[model samples]
Target: MRTGVNLAALATIALAFPSASSAQEWGFPGLGNAEFAAITAGGPAPRRDLTGAWDPGQAGIAGGDNYFNARTVPPLTPLGKEMLSRNRPTHGPYTAKVFEGNDPLTTQGDPSGFPRILNYEFRPMRIVQTPKAVLMLYSFNQSWRIIWTDGRALPQDPDPRWFGYSVGRWEDDTTFVVETVGLTERTWLDSGGFPHSEALRVQERYRRASENVIELTVTITDPLVYAKPWISRDRLPLKKLPEETDFLEQIYAASEVTGFKQNIADKARTQ
Candidate 1:
Protein backbone atom coordinates (compact mmCIF):
# COMPACT_ATOMS: atom_id res chain seq x y z
CA MET A 1 0.00 0.00 0.00
CA ARG A 2 1.06 3.62 -0.52
CA THR A 3 2.20 5.62 2.49
CA GLY A 4 1.16 9.14 1.51
CA VAL A 5 -1.39 10.79 -0.81
CA ASN A 6 -0.55 12.88 -3.82
CA LEU A 7 -2.70 15.31 -5.83
CA ALA A 8 -2.82 13.07 -8.91
CA ALA A 9 -3.95 10.09 -6.90
CA LEU A 10 -6.58 12.19 -5.12
CA ALA A 11 -7.81 13.80 -8.31
CA THR A 12 -8.16 10.58 -10.27
CA ILE A 13 -9.10 8.32 -7.34
CA ALA A 14 -6.63 5.84 -8.85
CA LEU A 15 -3.85 3.70 -7.41
CA ALA A 16 -0.69 2.59 -9.20
CA PHE A 17 0.34 -1.01 -8.62
CA PRO A 18 3.96 -1.46 -9.51
CA SER A 19 5.44 -4.42 -11.37
CA ALA A 20 6.80 -7.27 -9.25
CA SER A 21 10.31 -6.24 -10.16
CA SER A 22 9.67 -2.79 -8.65
CA ALA A 23 7.88 -3.99 -5.52
CA GLN A 24 10.60 -2.56 -3.29
CA GLU A 25 10.16 0.97 -4.59
CA TRP A 26 7.70 3.36 -2.94
CA GLY A 27 6.19 5.12 -5.95
CA PHE A 28 6.96 4.88 -9.65
CA PRO A 29 10.73 5.31 -9.56
CA GLY A 30 11.11 8.61 -11.38
CA LEU A 31 14.22 10.71 -11.15
CA GLY A 32 14.32 13.76 -8.93
CA ASN A 33 15.13 17.25 -10.23
CA ALA A 34 18.84 16.95 -9.42
CA GLU A 35 19.11 13.36 -10.58
CA PHE A 36 17.44 14.18 -13.89
CA ALA A 37 19.85 17.03 -14.45
CA ALA A 38 22.89 14.89 -13.73
CA ILE A 39 21.75 12.01 -15.91
CA THR A 40 20.73 14.21 -18.87
CA ALA A 41 24.06 16.03 -19.14
CA GLY A 42 25.74 14.18 -22.01
CA GLY A 43 25.93 14.67 -25.80
CA PRO A 44 23.80 16.31 -28.50
CA ALA A 45 20.34 14.96 -29.29
CA PRO A 46 19.58 12.87 -32.37
CA ARG A 47 17.60 14.27 -35.31
CA ARG A 48 13.93 13.41 -35.93
CA ASP A 49 13.81 10.75 -33.29
CA LEU A 50 11.73 10.77 -30.09
CA THR A 51 11.43 7.06 -29.40
CA GLY A 52 12.06 6.30 -25.73
CA ALA A 53 10.52 5.68 -22.34
CA TRP A 54 10.24 9.02 -20.56
CA ASP A 55 9.57 10.02 -16.97
CA PRO A 56 8.79 13.60 -16.00
CA GLY A 57 9.61 12.98 -12.35
CA GLN A 58 7.97 15.10 -9.63
CA ALA A 59 7.83 18.16 -11.88
CA GLY A 60 5.13 16.61 -14.09
CA ILE A 61 2.73 16.17 -11.17
CA ALA A 62 0.76 19.37 -10.78
CA GLY A 63 -1.03 20.19 -7.56
CA GLY A 64 -3.15 22.87 -9.23
CA ASP A 65 -3.04 24.61 -12.59
CA ASN A 66 -0.44 23.03 -14.88
CA TYR A 67 0.11 26.09 -17.04
CA PHE A 68 3.04 28.35 -16.32
CA ASN A 69 3.26 27.04 -12.72
CA ALA A 70 -0.19 28.51 -11.92
CA ARG A 71 1.30 32.01 -12.00
CA THR A 72 -0.51 33.12 -15.16
CA VAL A 73 -3.90 31.66 -16.04
CA PRO A 74 -5.49 33.99 -18.58
CA PRO A 75 -8.75 35.60 -17.62
CA LEU A 76 -11.79 33.69 -18.77
CA THR A 77 -14.65 35.09 -20.81
CA PRO A 78 -18.18 35.39 -19.44
CA LEU A 79 -19.33 32.11 -20.94
CA GLY A 80 -16.15 30.40 -19.83
CA LYS A 81 -16.56 31.64 -16.25
CA GLU A 82 -20.17 30.48 -16.18
CA MET A 83 -19.26 27.03 -17.47
CA LEU A 84 -16.36 26.70 -15.06
CA SER A 85 -18.54 27.70 -12.14
CA ARG A 86 -20.69 24.64 -12.70
CA ASN A 87 -17.82 22.16 -12.46
CA ARG A 88 -17.02 20.72 -9.03
CA PRO A 89 -13.47 19.41 -8.94
CA THR A 90 -11.97 17.54 -5.99
CA HIS A 91 -8.41 18.82 -6.32
CA GLY A 92 -6.72 22.24 -6.49
CA PRO A 93 -7.08 25.37 -4.34
CA TYR A 94 -10.78 25.84 -5.18
CA THR A 95 -11.71 22.22 -4.74
CA ALA A 96 -15.21 21.25 -3.73
CA LYS A 97 -16.18 18.54 -1.28
CA VAL A 98 -15.29 15.02 -2.35
CA PHE A 99 -18.91 14.05 -2.74
CA GLU A 100 -19.70 17.20 -4.69
CA GLY A 101 -17.06 16.71 -7.37
CA ASN A 102 -18.33 16.12 -10.91
CA ASP A 103 -15.03 15.19 -12.52
CA PRO A 104 -15.93 12.79 -15.36
CA LEU A 105 -12.78 10.70 -15.16
CA THR A 106 -12.82 10.31 -11.37
CA THR A 107 -16.53 9.93 -10.64
CA GLN A 108 -17.77 8.17 -13.80
CA GLY A 109 -14.57 6.62 -15.16
CA ASP A 110 -14.73 8.53 -18.44
CA PRO A 111 -11.64 8.79 -20.58
CA SER A 112 -9.30 11.56 -19.33
CA GLY A 113 -9.07 12.88 -22.93
CA PHE A 114 -6.73 15.24 -24.79
CA PRO A 115 -4.97 17.91 -22.75
CA ARG A 116 -6.30 16.47 -19.52
CA ILE A 117 -4.24 13.33 -20.18
CA LEU A 118 -1.09 15.44 -20.32
CA ASN A 119 -2.08 17.99 -17.69
CA TYR A 120 -3.08 15.78 -14.77
CA GLU A 121 -1.70 12.52 -13.48
CA PHE A 122 1.05 12.97 -16.03
CA ARG A 123 3.03 9.81 -15.45
CA PRO A 124 5.76 7.87 -17.14
CA MET A 125 5.01 7.27 -20.84
CA ARG A 126 6.57 5.63 -23.84
CA ILE A 127 6.93 7.30 -27.25
CA VAL A 128 7.17 5.10 -30.29
CA GLN A 129 7.97 6.59 -33.67
CA THR A 130 6.37 4.76 -36.54
CA PRO A 131 6.64 5.45 -40.24
CA LYS A 132 3.12 6.85 -40.38
CA ALA A 133 2.53 8.17 -36.86
CA VAL A 134 4.02 8.83 -33.46
CA LEU A 135 2.27 6.80 -30.78
CA MET A 136 2.20 7.79 -27.14
CA LEU A 137 1.50 5.13 -24.57
CA TYR A 138 0.66 6.60 -21.18
CA SER A 139 1.13 4.67 -17.99
CA PHE A 140 -1.84 6.41 -16.40
CA ASN A 141 -5.11 4.61 -17.18
CA GLN A 142 -3.13 2.51 -19.65
CA SER A 143 -4.17 4.85 -22.46
CA TRP A 144 -2.58 5.53 -25.81
CA ARG A 145 -2.84 8.18 -28.56
CA ILE A 146 -1.53 8.48 -32.08
CA ILE A 147 -0.22 11.58 -33.77
CA TRP A 148 -0.09 11.30 -37.54
CA THR A 149 3.19 12.37 -39.13
CA ASP A 150 2.59 11.41 -42.74
CA GLY A 151 1.77 14.93 -43.97
CA ARG A 152 -1.98 14.94 -43.71
CA ALA A 153 -4.11 18.02 -43.05
CA LEU A 154 -6.38 18.35 -40.01
CA PRO A 155 -9.87 17.06 -40.54
CA GLN A 156 -12.63 19.55 -41.36
CA ASP A 157 -15.89 19.43 -39.39
CA PRO A 158 -14.93 16.11 -37.91
CA ASP A 159 -16.77 14.39 -35.10
CA PRO A 160 -15.23 15.26 -31.77
CA ARG A 161 -13.28 12.52 -30.05
CA TRP A 162 -12.05 12.01 -26.53
CA PHE A 163 -8.38 12.03 -27.52
CA GLY A 164 -8.96 14.24 -30.59
CA TYR A 165 -7.07 14.26 -33.88
CA SER A 166 -3.41 15.17 -33.88
CA VAL A 167 -0.80 15.80 -36.56
CA GLY A 168 2.88 16.30 -35.96
CA ARG A 169 5.83 17.64 -37.90
CA TRP A 170 9.48 18.30 -37.40
CA GLU A 171 9.83 22.02 -36.74
CA ASP A 172 13.61 21.84 -36.75
CA ASP A 173 16.39 19.32 -36.37
CA THR A 174 15.85 19.20 -32.62
CA THR A 175 12.22 20.29 -32.20
CA PHE A 176 9.05 18.32 -33.02
CA VAL A 177 5.66 20.02 -32.91
CA VAL A 178 2.16 18.55 -32.69
CA GLU A 179 -1.17 20.25 -33.32
CA THR A 180 -4.44 18.78 -32.03
CA VAL A 181 -8.07 19.66 -32.66
CA GLY A 182 -11.59 18.20 -32.67
CA LEU A 183 -11.56 17.55 -28.94
CA THR A 184 -14.78 17.07 -27.01
CA GLU A 185 -15.35 19.69 -24.35
CA ARG A 186 -16.32 17.07 -21.75
CA THR A 187 -12.80 16.92 -20.26
CA TRP A 188 -11.60 19.62 -17.93
CA LEU A 189 -8.45 21.51 -18.86
CA ASP A 190 -6.75 20.36 -15.69
CA SER A 191 -7.61 19.30 -12.17
CA GLY A 192 -8.80 22.89 -11.74
CA GLY A 193 -11.92 22.39 -13.93
CA PHE A 194 -10.92 24.97 -16.49
CA PRO A 195 -13.41 24.85 -19.39
CA HIS A 196 -12.73 24.91 -23.08
CA SER A 197 -14.89 25.23 -26.19
CA GLU A 198 -15.18 23.03 -29.25
CA ALA A 199 -12.92 25.54 -30.92
CA LEU A 200 -10.08 24.68 -28.60
CA ARG A 201 -6.78 24.10 -30.31
CA VAL A 202 -3.74 22.65 -28.59
CA GLN A 203 -0.14 22.86 -29.73
CA GLU A 204 2.62 20.75 -28.25
CA ARG A 205 6.30 21.45 -28.77
CA TYR A 206 8.86 18.81 -27.95
CA ARG A 207 12.48 19.84 -28.06
CA ARG A 208 15.24 17.31 -27.73
CA ALA A 209 17.62 19.10 -25.44
CA SER A 210 20.12 16.27 -25.09
CA GLU A 211 20.54 12.58 -25.69
CA ASN A 212 18.63 11.78 -22.51
CA VAL A 213 16.21 14.70 -22.15
CA ILE A 214 13.31 16.31 -23.99
CA GLU A 215 11.66 19.57 -23.00
CA LEU A 216 7.91 19.82 -23.68
CA THR A 217 5.63 22.86 -23.86
CA VAL A 218 1.88 22.95 -24.50
CA THR A 219 -0.24 25.92 -25.53
CA ILE A 220 -4.03 26.14 -25.24
CA THR A 221 -6.02 28.47 -27.46
CA ASP A 222 -9.80 28.78 -27.25
CA PRO A 223 -11.27 32.05 -28.31
CA LEU A 224 -14.66 31.27 -26.80
CA VAL A 225 -13.21 30.51 -23.39
CA TYR A 226 -10.21 32.68 -22.59
CA ALA A 227 -9.38 36.20 -23.61
CA LYS A 228 -6.01 35.04 -24.87
CA PRO A 229 -3.99 31.89 -25.36
CA TRP A 230 -1.92 30.57 -22.47
CA ILE A 231 0.76 27.96 -21.88
CA SER A 232 -0.34 24.84 -20.09
CA ARG A 233 3.01 23.09 -19.68
CA ASP A 234 6.14 25.19 -19.84
CA ARG A 235 9.37 23.48 -20.66
CA LEU A 236 8.60 20.37 -18.57
CA PRO A 237 11.65 18.12 -18.81
CA LEU A 238 11.20 14.40 -19.46
CA LYS A 239 14.15 12.19 -18.57
CA LYS A 240 14.74 9.05 -20.58
CA LEU A 241 14.44 5.63 -19.02
CA PRO A 242 15.92 2.34 -20.08
CA GLU A 243 14.17 0.40 -22.86
CA GLU A 244 13.21 -2.48 -20.58
CA THR A 245 11.66 -0.31 -17.86
CA ASP A 246 8.21 -1.45 -16.81
CA PHE A 247 5.40 0.93 -15.82
CA LEU A 248 2.74 0.38 -13.20
CA GLU A 249 -0.80 -0.45 -14.24
CA GLN A 250 -2.95 2.49 -13.16
CA ILE A 251 -6.49 1.94 -14.42
CA TYR A 252 -9.46 3.60 -12.70
CA ALA A 253 -12.48 1.46 -13.47
CA ALA A 254 -16.01 2.61 -12.65
CA SER A 255 -17.03 -0.46 -10.70
CA GLU A 256 -13.90 -0.25 -8.56
CA VAL A 257 -14.57 3.39 -7.71
CA THR A 258 -18.17 2.59 -6.84
CA GLY A 259 -17.11 -0.09 -4.40
CA PHE A 260 -14.46 2.10 -2.81
CA LYS A 261 -16.87 4.99 -2.40
CA GLN A 262 -19.44 2.78 -0.75
CA ASN A 263 -16.93 1.19 1.59
CA ILE A 264 -14.46 3.97 2.37
CA ALA A 265 -15.43 7.43 1.10
CA ASP A 266 -19.10 7.21 2.00
CA LYS A 267 -18.11 6.36 5.56
CA ALA A 268 -16.48 9.79 5.79
CA ARG A 269 -19.69 11.58 4.83
CA THR A 270 -21.43 10.21 7.92
CA GLN A 271 -18.59 11.34 10.17
Candidate 2:
Protein backbone atom coordinates (compact mmCIF):
# COMPACT_ATOMS: atom_id res chain seq x y z
CA MET A 1 0.00 0.00 0.00
CA ARG A 2 3.04 2.34 0.62
CA THR A 3 4.27 1.77 -2.93
CA GLY A 4 0.80 2.45 -4.30
CA VAL A 5 0.62 5.71 -2.29
CA ASN A 6 4.06 6.75 -3.64
CA LEU A 7 2.84 6.28 -7.27
CA ALA A 8 -0.34 8.29 -6.56
CA ALA A 9 1.73 11.14 -5.06
CA LEU A 10 3.90 11.28 -8.17
CA ALA A 11 0.79 11.54 -10.39
CA THR A 12 -0.58 14.39 -8.26
CA ILE A 13 2.71 16.29 -8.53
CA ALA A 14 2.72 15.85 -12.31
CA LEU A 15 -0.84 17.20 -12.60
CA ALA A 16 -0.20 20.16 -10.28
CA PHE A 17 2.96 21.55 -11.97
CA PRO A 18 2.93 21.59 -15.74
CA SER A 19 6.16 21.59 -17.78
CA ALA A 20 7.33 24.94 -19.15
CA SER A 21 6.70 23.86 -22.72
CA SER A 22 3.24 22.59 -21.82
CA ALA A 23 2.41 25.81 -20.02
CA GLN A 24 3.49 27.85 -23.05
CA GLU A 25 1.46 25.64 -25.44
CA TRP A 26 -1.64 25.87 -23.25
CA GLY A 27 -1.38 29.72 -23.00
CA PHE A 28 -1.28 29.88 -19.22
CA PRO A 29 -1.91 33.24 -17.54
CA GLY A 30 0.62 34.04 -14.80
CA LEU A 31 4.08 35.45 -14.14
CA GLY A 32 5.64 32.39 -15.79
CA ASN A 33 3.61 32.88 -19.03
CA ALA A 34 5.48 33.61 -22.26
CA GLU A 35 4.51 37.23 -22.92
CA PHE A 36 4.25 38.45 -19.36
CA ALA A 37 7.12 36.40 -17.97
CA ALA A 38 9.74 39.05 -18.67
CA ILE A 39 7.62 41.91 -17.34
CA THR A 40 6.59 40.02 -14.27
CA ALA A 41 10.22 39.13 -13.61
CA GLY A 42 11.03 42.88 -13.40
CA GLY A 43 12.64 43.04 -16.83
CA PRO A 44 11.30 44.82 -19.94
CA ALA A 45 12.45 45.36 -23.50
CA PRO A 46 15.05 48.09 -23.97
CA ARG A 47 13.81 51.32 -25.54
CA ARG A 48 15.56 52.61 -28.65
CA ASP A 49 17.42 55.93 -28.47
CA LEU A 50 17.63 58.06 -31.62
CA THR A 51 20.92 59.70 -30.82
CA GLY A 52 23.39 59.29 -33.65
CA ALA A 53 24.63 60.63 -36.96
CA TRP A 54 22.46 59.31 -39.79
CA ASP A 55 22.58 59.20 -43.58
CA PRO A 56 19.47 59.53 -45.68
CA GLY A 57 18.59 56.32 -47.49
CA GLN A 58 17.11 55.80 -50.95
CA ALA A 59 14.19 58.08 -51.78
CA GLY A 60 12.79 56.70 -55.05
CA ILE A 61 11.57 59.67 -57.01
CA ALA A 62 12.15 59.77 -60.73
CA GLY A 63 13.58 63.01 -62.17
CA GLY A 64 13.78 64.44 -58.67
CA ASP A 65 16.77 64.88 -56.42
CA ASN A 66 15.24 65.05 -52.94
CA TYR A 67 12.59 63.64 -50.58
CA PHE A 68 9.72 65.35 -52.42
CA ASN A 69 10.61 63.52 -55.61
CA ALA A 70 7.86 60.91 -55.42
CA ARG A 71 5.03 63.11 -54.24
CA THR A 72 2.34 63.92 -56.79
CA VAL A 73 1.47 67.54 -57.11
CA PRO A 74 -1.40 68.14 -54.72
CA PRO A 75 -4.71 69.28 -56.17
CA LEU A 76 -3.91 72.84 -55.31
CA THR A 77 -6.46 75.57 -54.76
CA PRO A 78 -6.17 78.59 -57.05
CA LEU A 79 -3.74 80.33 -54.75
CA GLY A 80 -1.67 77.19 -54.35
CA LYS A 81 -1.28 76.69 -58.09
CA GLU A 82 -0.32 80.30 -58.52
CA MET A 83 2.30 79.90 -55.83
CA LEU A 84 3.64 76.75 -57.43
CA SER A 85 3.80 78.37 -60.84
CA ARG A 86 5.98 81.07 -59.37
CA ASN A 87 8.57 78.61 -57.95
CA ARG A 88 11.62 78.25 -60.23
CA PRO A 89 14.26 75.89 -58.99
CA THR A 90 17.48 76.16 -61.03
CA HIS A 91 17.18 72.63 -62.47
CA GLY A 92 13.45 72.03 -62.02
CA PRO A 93 11.06 71.30 -64.87
CA TYR A 94 9.77 74.89 -65.04
CA THR A 95 13.02 76.89 -64.97
CA ALA A 96 16.12 77.40 -67.12
CA LYS A 97 19.54 76.37 -65.78
CA VAL A 98 20.85 79.93 -65.95
CA PHE A 99 17.86 81.31 -64.05
CA GLU A 100 18.22 80.75 -60.33
CA GLY A 101 14.87 79.31 -59.26
CA ASN A 102 13.12 81.11 -56.47
CA ASP A 103 14.25 78.49 -53.99
CA PRO A 104 15.00 80.37 -50.78
CA LEU A 105 18.17 78.31 -50.47
CA THR A 106 19.42 80.15 -53.56
CA THR A 107 19.41 83.23 -51.32
CA GLN A 108 21.16 81.25 -48.58
CA GLY A 109 17.96 81.10 -46.53
CA ASP A 110 17.26 78.30 -44.03
CA PRO A 111 16.02 75.36 -46.11
CA SER A 112 12.69 76.96 -45.19
CA GLY A 113 11.48 74.10 -42.94
CA PHE A 114 11.19 70.38 -42.21
CA PRO A 115 10.20 68.67 -45.45
CA ARG A 116 12.41 71.03 -47.37
CA ILE A 117 15.35 70.37 -45.09
CA LEU A 118 14.85 66.60 -45.41
CA ASN A 119 14.43 66.76 -49.18
CA TYR A 120 17.08 69.18 -50.38
CA GLU A 121 20.00 68.49 -48.08
CA PHE A 122 21.88 65.21 -48.54
CA ARG A 123 24.38 65.68 -45.72
CA PRO A 124 24.35 63.66 -42.52
CA MET A 125 22.35 64.73 -39.45
CA ARG A 126 22.91 64.22 -35.74
CA ILE A 127 20.20 63.88 -33.10
CA VAL A 128 20.76 64.79 -29.45
CA GLN A 129 18.19 63.66 -26.94
CA THR A 130 17.70 64.97 -23.40
CA PRO A 131 14.98 64.76 -20.81
CA LYS A 132 13.42 68.11 -21.74
CA ALA A 133 14.09 68.37 -25.48
CA VAL A 134 15.47 66.69 -28.58
CA LEU A 135 17.82 68.60 -30.86
CA MET A 136 18.39 67.82 -34.51
CA LEU A 137 21.61 69.27 -35.84
CA TYR A 138 21.90 69.29 -39.61
CA SER A 139 25.07 69.52 -41.60
CA PHE A 140 23.26 71.73 -44.09
CA ASN A 141 23.50 75.46 -43.35
CA GLN A 142 24.46 74.52 -39.78
CA SER A 143 20.78 74.56 -38.88
CA TRP A 144 19.25 73.03 -35.78
CA ARG A 145 15.71 72.34 -34.62
CA ILE A 146 14.55 72.12 -31.04
CA ILE A 147 11.72 69.72 -30.24
CA TRP A 148 10.43 70.34 -26.76
CA THR A 149 9.46 67.09 -25.01
CA ASP A 150 9.01 68.45 -21.49
CA GLY A 151 5.23 68.06 -21.35
CA ARG A 152 4.70 71.76 -22.03
CA ALA A 153 1.60 72.60 -24.05
CA LEU A 154 2.14 74.08 -27.52
CA PRO A 155 1.65 77.78 -27.66
CA GLN A 156 -1.73 78.96 -28.93
CA ASP A 157 -0.32 81.92 -30.85
CA PRO A 158 3.37 81.44 -31.18
CA ASP A 159 5.47 83.94 -33.10
CA PRO A 160 6.33 82.68 -36.56
CA ARG A 161 9.74 81.07 -36.93
CA TRP A 162 11.75 79.96 -39.92
CA PHE A 163 11.94 76.38 -38.64
CA GLY A 164 8.62 76.46 -36.78
CA TYR A 165 7.83 75.67 -33.16
CA SER A 166 7.96 71.95 -32.51
CA VAL A 167 6.77 69.68 -29.71
CA GLY A 168 7.44 65.97 -29.41
CA ARG A 169 6.34 62.97 -27.37
CA TRP A 170 7.03 59.27 -27.43
CA GLU A 171 4.09 57.42 -28.96
CA ASP A 172 5.48 54.05 -27.94
CA ASP A 173 8.79 52.83 -26.70
CA THR A 174 10.05 52.78 -30.30
CA THR A 175 8.16 55.60 -31.98
CA PHE A 176 8.48 59.37 -31.52
CA VAL A 177 5.87 61.79 -32.82
CA VAL A 178 6.42 65.54 -33.41
CA GLU A 179 4.02 68.33 -34.29
CA THR A 180 5.24 71.69 -35.68
CA VAL A 181 3.42 74.92 -36.33
CA GLY A 182 3.88 78.71 -36.34
CA LEU A 183 6.12 78.54 -39.41
CA THR A 184 6.89 81.64 -41.38
CA GLU A 185 4.97 81.80 -44.67
CA ARG A 186 8.10 83.02 -46.46
CA THR A 187 9.65 79.58 -46.67
CA TRP A 188 8.86 76.92 -49.26
CA LEU A 189 7.91 73.42 -48.19
CA ASP A 190 10.26 71.55 -50.53
CA SER A 191 13.06 72.09 -53.02
CA GLY A 192 10.45 71.32 -55.66
CA GLY A 193 8.77 74.55 -54.61
CA PHE A 194 5.79 73.21 -52.72
CA PRO A 195 4.15 76.12 -50.94
CA HIS A 196 2.69 76.33 -47.46
CA SER A 197 0.96 79.16 -45.66
CA GLU A 198 1.27 80.17 -42.05
CA ALA A 199 -1.72 77.90 -41.46
CA LEU A 200 0.38 74.81 -42.17
CA ARG A 201 0.88 72.11 -39.56
CA VAL A 202 3.44 69.35 -39.98
CA GLN A 203 3.28 65.97 -38.27
CA GLU A 204 6.34 63.77 -38.20
CA ARG A 205 6.51 60.16 -37.04
CA TYR A 206 9.94 58.70 -36.38
CA ARG A 207 10.45 55.01 -35.65
CA ARG A 208 13.75 53.37 -34.89
CA ALA A 209 13.55 50.16 -36.91
CA SER A 210 16.79 48.74 -35.53
CA GLU A 211 20.12 49.84 -34.19
CA ASN A 212 21.23 50.82 -37.67
CA VAL A 213 18.05 52.17 -39.27
CA ILE A 214 15.40 54.77 -38.50
CA GLU A 215 12.23 55.36 -40.53
CA LEU A 216 10.44 58.70 -40.81
CA THR A 217 7.02 59.65 -42.19
CA VAL A 218 5.75 63.20 -42.63
CA THR A 219 2.20 64.47 -43.06
CA ILE A 220 1.39 68.04 -44.09
CA THR A 221 -1.94 69.69 -43.42
CA ASP A 222 -2.70 73.03 -45.01
CA PRO A 223 -6.33 73.92 -45.63
CA LEU A 224 -5.32 76.89 -47.72
CA VAL A 225 -3.20 74.91 -50.20
CA TYR A 226 -4.66 71.43 -50.60
CA ALA A 227 -8.12 69.88 -50.74
CA LYS A 228 -7.02 67.31 -48.17
CA PRO A 229 -4.04 66.36 -46.04
CA TRP A 230 -0.89 65.22 -47.85
CA ILE A 231 0.86 62.25 -46.26
CA SER A 232 4.04 61.05 -47.94
CA ARG A 233 4.10 57.38 -48.95
CA ASP A 234 7.88 57.16 -49.00
CA ARG A 235 9.55 55.56 -46.02
CA LEU A 236 12.65 57.60 -45.28
CA PRO A 237 15.14 55.11 -43.89
CA LEU A 238 18.07 56.86 -42.25
CA LYS A 239 21.12 54.67 -41.81
CA LYS A 240 23.46 55.06 -38.89
CA LEU A 241 26.78 56.73 -39.55
CA PRO A 242 30.14 56.06 -38.00
CA GLU A 243 30.91 57.77 -34.71
CA GLU A 244 33.87 59.57 -36.26
CA THR A 245 31.85 61.13 -39.07
CA ASP A 246 32.15 64.89 -38.99
CA PHE A 247 29.24 67.28 -39.58
CA LEU A 248 31.12 70.17 -41.12
CA GLU A 249 29.71 73.66 -41.09
CA GLN A 250 28.01 74.75 -44.34
CA ILE A 251 28.17 78.51 -44.30
CA TYR A 252 26.52 80.43 -47.15
CA ALA A 253 28.44 83.69 -47.17
CA ALA A 254 28.64 84.42 -50.89
CA SER A 255 27.31 87.92 -51.56
CA GLU A 256 26.74 87.78 -55.29
CA VAL A 257 24.27 85.62 -57.25
CA THR A 258 27.09 84.46 -59.54
CA GLY A 259 29.15 83.49 -56.50
CA PHE A 260 26.17 81.62 -55.08
CA LYS A 261 25.70 79.59 -58.26
CA GLN A 262 29.40 78.80 -58.52
CA ASN A 263 29.69 77.82 -54.85
CA ILE A 264 26.58 75.63 -54.91
CA ALA A 265 27.59 73.94 -58.14
CA ASP A 266 31.06 73.21 -56.79
CA LYS A 267 29.61 71.67 -53.63
CA ALA A 268 27.16 69.54 -55.61
CA ARG A 269 29.93 68.15 -57.79
CA THR A 270 31.89 66.97 -54.75
CA GLN A 271 28.82 65.20 -53.27
Write down the RMSD of all candidates, one decimal each.
7.9, 16.5
lDDT at position 57, candidate 2: 31
Q: Candidate 2 residues 201-259, lDDT tens each?
A: 88888887765557788788888887678875346766554333455565444355447
How accurate locally, in lDDT, is each candidate? 0.77, 0.62
Worst 10 residues of 1 by lDDT: 12-21
Which ten-residue region of model 2 has the weakest summed lDDT? 33-42
TM-score of candidate 2 against the unseen true structure: 0.72
Against the true structure, candidate 1 reaches a TM-score of 0.85
**Angstrom error at residue 14, model 2:** 56
Q: Relative to the unseen true structure, what is the C-alpha lDDT of residue 94 in candidate 2, on a scale of 0 to 100?
A: 52
lDDT of 2: 0.62
Angstrom error at residue 58, model 1: 1.4
